[model samples]
Target: MTIRPIVRYPDPRLALPAQPVTVFDGALRELASDLLETMHAAPGIGITAPHIGISLRVVVLDLDPVDGARTYVNPEIIWASPEMILHQEGSVSMPGVNDDIRRHARVRIGYRDIDGNAQTEESGGLRAVCHQHEIDQLNGVFWIQRLSRLKRERLVKRFEKLSRG
Candidate 1:
């Protein structure tokens, strides 16, 4: 597996909605592998396909230190609780910026495995927030979108300055 370059913020592709995966085959598997490698290289717990410019409903997560990687194809949040929790979240695509965002404390997600088998899992805490964050990227939503208007403007200005440099 090769580490793919993450498409940074302000990249149009990061804001564009990804296409659904119609054909689940070797290419998709390779994409998952590459995503894992990229996530590991970034030292991040989660990654979405759109972050790498693939624009597909795919994500890789490895929140556990011992367990193997978790690959999700066409992941969808099935259920979310009303109870909200604030977590300081960061993204590989947007380095050096962390935002405290409110998200569902618990969520049930459904998605397809690498073998084309359907799977559902319940998660909470950092895992839940990370999963939801990455899934949002699959739909072209960034964590900055969850921030207040002033914070969003500040982040955009920071990113703009970084780009200028």
Candidate 2:
């Protein structure tokens, strides 16, 4: 697996909706492997296909080293609880900037495995937050877009400064 360059923030691709994976083949597996490597290099807990200029609906998450990694294909949120939680959300695309964003405390998502098997996961806490965050990205809604206008502007400025320095 190769570590691919992450697509930076404000890139038009990050705002474009990703297409569902139509074929589950070796190339798909390789892409997932590459995503894991790239996420690790980015030092991010999660990443999506669009994060690396791949317009496919795939996500790789490794919240715990012990748990290893998980690949979600064409993931869609099937359910979300009314309870909300505030979690600090950042992106591999926009490194060095983060903000607490409100998200569902619990979520259930349906997705396919790398081998094309269907899977559903119910999660709470950080896992739930990740599910929502990455799924939003697949829908072309960057994490900062969920922030208040003032907060989004401030975070973008901070990211810009970091990029320059």
Q: What is the lDDT of residue 107 in candidate 1?
A: 95
In order of appearance, the predictions have TM-scores of 0.93, 0.99
Candidate 1 lDDT, tens digit per residue, 87-132? 9988889877787999999999999998888899999998899889
Q: Candidate 2 clashing pairs?
A: none
RMSD of each: 1.4, 0.6
Give the per-residue lDDT of model 2 (tens digit) for 50-155.
Answer: 9999999999999977999999999999999999999999999999999999999999999999999999999999999999999999999999999999999999
User: Best candidate per lDDT, number?
Assistant: 2
Count the clashes in each prediction. 0, 0
Q: Considering summed lDDT, which 10 consecutive residues are worst modelled in model 1?
A: 156-165
Off by over 4 Å in 2: none
Best-fitting candidate, measured by TM-score? 2
- Give lDDT for model 2: 0.96
